[model samples]
Target: MNRVPVSSSNLSSVGYDESNQVLEIEFHGGRVYQYFDVPQRIHQELMNAGSHGKYFHRNIEDKYRYDQVK
Candidate 1:
């Protein structure tokens, strides 16, 4: 997955795989996680949001199944 860097205190970048509904998020402390069963719209909204970290916590975090990548 190709992640795009974002400006966020808690988040670093994001990547999405639409075919498999996987959303990958990289955090500032080098922790990376992949969320499963994510909708493309949620990924789009997250990328477009002004506060990526806030959006992730409020919308994506704990909402989908995920695994730590790094």
Candidate 2:
């Protein structure tokens, strides 16, 4: 997966592996996490949202299985 930097106070960057359905997120304080079993639609919405942090909290946080990568 290729991570792309985003404009968000609560997020640093984001990445998605479509074949595996995994969504990777890097937070402001150097925390990294991979959320599994995420749909591509959700990923796209997150990317296009006005507030990445808000979109994540409302749609993704605690909604899928995840693992801390850093």
Instruction: For candidate 1, write residues 9-60 as lDDT tens digits.
Output: 9999999999999999999989999999999999999999989999999999
Worst 10 residues of 2 by lDDT: 1-10
- Give per-residue CA lDDT, model 2, range 1-70, as digits (tens): 6799999999999999999999999999999999999999999999999999999999999999999989
- Write out the backbone clash pairs for model 1: none
Per-prediction TM-score, please?
0.97, 0.97
List candidate 2 segments past 4 Å from native: none
User: Which model scores highest in TM-score?
Assistant: 2
lDDT, each prediction: 0.95, 0.97
